[model samples]
Structures are given as C-alpha cells and as structure tokens.
Target: MDPSSVIWIFFVFLFFYPQVLFRYRLLQRYKFIKQFEAVRKTRAIVMIHRQEQLALFGIPLYKYITIEDSEEILRAIRMTPEDMPIDLILHTPGGLVLASEQIAIALKEHKAKTTVIIPHYAMSGGSLIALAADEIIIDKNAVMGPVDPQIGQYPAASIINAINTKYTDELDDETLILGDIARKAIVQVKEFVYDILKDKMGEEKAKYLSETLSTGKWTHDYPLTINKLKDLGIEVNTELPNIVYELFDLYRQPVNQRPSVQYVPVPYKRGTKK
Candidate 1:
C-alpha cells in the first residue's frame, strides 16, 4: 500500500475505535439481559446491592433497597404485561422494611406467577419479599435470614424482652414507651409474614413459620438454607439451573477496577533560539 493510503487508514481507524468499543459493550449488556429473560421464561428484575462507594462529589452512596428502588420496581411491573410472569433476581443484605414490603406487595399482586431467585444471601427484609413469591429458588450456598424487625440497631423482640424482665416500677418512662412500640412492631411483622405465607402454605403452617421467623427464635442474621426452609414447609429449590448461575455470573461485581484508555494530547514544542 502507498504511504499516504496507510496514513489515511490509520487515522480513520483511530477516529472510530472508541465508538466501536462502546457499541460492543452495549451489545454485550443487552445480550446478557435478554438471555436471562429468555432462559427463565419470565421478565427478569435484578436487585443487587453493590458495595458502598463514594460519588463524584465524595458523598457516600449506599446500595440498599430504598423507596426509590420500590418506585423503579413498580414502574417495571407496569411496563410488563399483566399476563407475563416475573423472576426477581435478589442479592442483597436486606434494607428498609417499608421499602421491602412495598416490593413484596407489588409482587404478590402481580397477575402472573412470581419467582424469587436468591443467588447468594437475601436476608431480613429481603426474606419478606421472597415470601411473596410463588416459588423460591436458591443455589446450594444461598441463604435467607430471619425477618425479625429491627428498630434502629435493636431487635424488637430484645427490646420487648428487656421490658418484660423489669418490674413496672423499675422501668423508666422512655423505656416503657420503647417497649410498647417494640411489642406492637413484633405483632405487626408477624402478622405481615403470616399473611404473605398463608396463600403459599395453609393458614396453620403459615402462622407457625411466621411466628418462628419473626419472634427472634434465631439471631437476626441466621441463615435459613434450602434444607432448613424445606423443613419449614416452604417451597424451595436447592438445585439452581445453569441459566440462573449464568445470570448470577453476569451480575457479579468485579473485584478489580475497570481498565480505561485515555487520549493525551502531545505537547507542541517551539524551535529553540540559536
């Protein structure tokens, strides 16, 4: 090839390189999303919690379920046809109870079958949402935790117990007030869990599981593995399909920083004076 032609081809390739790379990455992301939906035979929604990171302005960003997340989930449900099933891909340490309940209600009310896939651990409020699903699928290593409500950092049951151990005269006004609130919260959470489970299991079994899970029989972070859930009469699948693992792999966070290439303009030099 002629030197001029070679130079022209090099410049043209350089001009379009970044655009080509960007389009390729976009296509890859689209393919992964579509593949997950296709394999599951349902509309897939992912709720993964990323590690906390600092934003561009140095503000801390948390990746827990929030009210905004519930709004987005509702929006997605609205966009999907009523007859279409949904598969929720959950990978969270759980978050706000109110937010989780909002999602759980939406999922329960969805016209089609709903399934929750726990790729790793879905604990606390996350378990509440999973209870709304028709079926729960988890990897062998995946776990669900007790749904005992927490007020600030204190477990509701613990607060109530502390009050019970003290005489009425020994309790201060504030302690009595907090104990009352905690007792009410415990009842509310147990009732919510019972309602969610009643349709899945019979009312009797649902009531049993709900009380057991919400009354702090186990620590808040206790892992309910697939076998344990099965023993509790919950419909749980231990063997995850290959496609589920593929989706999990797609959602896995990278341990290392992403590499980037940036263009730096060459400094222009003036001829030195002799």
Candidate 2:
C-alpha cells in the first residue's frame, strides 16, 4: 500500500480495534509517573464498595477486589526502594472493618516512612485504616469520615424501628429488647471510634471524637476539617506542595480526563451474615 493509503488503513484499524486503544491507555498508565515522580515509585492504592458499584462517576471498574490484594500490598512494600518513602492511597466508604484494619496495620508496620493519602472520601471503617498510618495527607477537597462502627445498615435500622415503636405505642417486651440492642450498638460504636482515635490521637481525644461520631449525624464530617483532626491531635498534612497540589487537582478531573488513581481493589468477600 502507498504510505498515505497505509496511514488511512491504520486509522481505520484502530477505530475497529478498540481494545488496542484500551491497551495503549493501559500502557501509558503502566509507566505513569505522577508530577512528583519520586512519590509514585512507592505508592499503593485501594478502593472499595458494598456491592457491585465500582464505577465512580460511571467509570467501568470492578466489583470485587476493587483495591489491593494481600500479595499486591506485599509487592508494593517489597518493590519500594528501601531508602525511599512510601504512600498508601485509600478511597473507601468503610468496607469490612477487620479487612480495613489489617491493611492499615500492615501499612503502619512497614519499615519505610509511611504516609496515608486520602484523595477523596474515606469514611467509617475506612477511617480506621487511615488512623494506622504514621502521617495522613488529606487534600483540601479530600475527607476522612468519622469512624463510628456499626453492625452494617439493617440492625441499626431495626434499633431505630424499636425506638420509634416504643415512643408511639408505649413499652412492649419486644420494644424493650430492641431498645437494649440499640443502646448496646451505640455504646459499642462509641467505644470502637474511641479506640481508633486512641491510636491516632490519644485516649482523651479519642473518647471525645467517639461520642461525637456515634450521633450518625457526623459520619462524613468534613466541615470540622483539619481543625477536628488537630483537636484529636491526629497529625494532618493538608497543605500540599504547590506542584503536588497542581498535579492533584489535575488528577481529580473526571475519569475521562484523569486516569483512575484509585485503589486497585482486591478479591474480598463481604460478610454473609452482615
């Protein structure tokens, strides 16, 4: 074929071979270096969801293992240069707390100077994991939610039901039982948040945050912002370097414009009983 004709054919081929286009995009991401190239070398990412909703802004991703697997986590640690610093990126709405906790603890225990980076929202159980990191970096637009642990969404609803019923129809034995469950849940969640804060902040501040967090009103309390974190004595680095800030703002554009800088989800089974 003539050179001009060959170019035309190549364009048509690429139009038909979309997977090639996708592979090309993946190739770009494979060697993708953040503006702060040094930081990307030792970074880990994790993402999460309750069910099959992996798409943030309708970007096609995965349902299960949407974040890093255990092996991947180890790989990130191992691949990181021994002398370089490391950062763990988390974008989770608080999945299995135990799983989140394990990841958080592992990141914490790693020998490298570790930092937790929250580019968007990390709430509930996810916040617990963020607490384990030595330092936490929350972008100006990013937020870490209150770590008020609960027994999933149903039991909490059931307890609320019992309270409403008790108020409407006076006390029944069943209502009283439900009341007990609700109270226990409140206390347990309170304690859980407290314990998490204790590790990140200290005992006194953890107690305060725990009580404030359980109200269900402050699950994603970003308004408190860095002030609240400071109150807890949780060290937060909110002011990013100007260049890093520029890169972060660029990376946060819609998925089409920005590659997924999200957690590589790992295969994780949700609790059947939960």
Q: Which predicted model would earn the best lDDT?
A: 1
lDDT of 1 by residue, 1-274 (tens): 9999999999999778757766655455456656776666567777777564443355554467778778777766766667777788787878888889988999999988998888898999889999999888888889999999888789999998888897999988998888888888889989999988888688999899989999989889999998898888778877666776664564343322221111111221222111
Q: Candidate 2 overall Cα lDDT vs. reference?
A: 0.56
What are the models' TM-scores? 0.78, 0.60
Scanning candidate 1 in windows of ten residues, the lowest lDDT window is: 259-268
- Which runs of model 2 end up more than 4 angstroms from their true locations? 1-18, 33-71, 78-84, 150-196, 214-224, 241-274
- lDDT scores for all predictions? 0.76, 0.56
Error of 1 at 76 (Å): 1.0
lDDT of model 1 at residue 97? 84
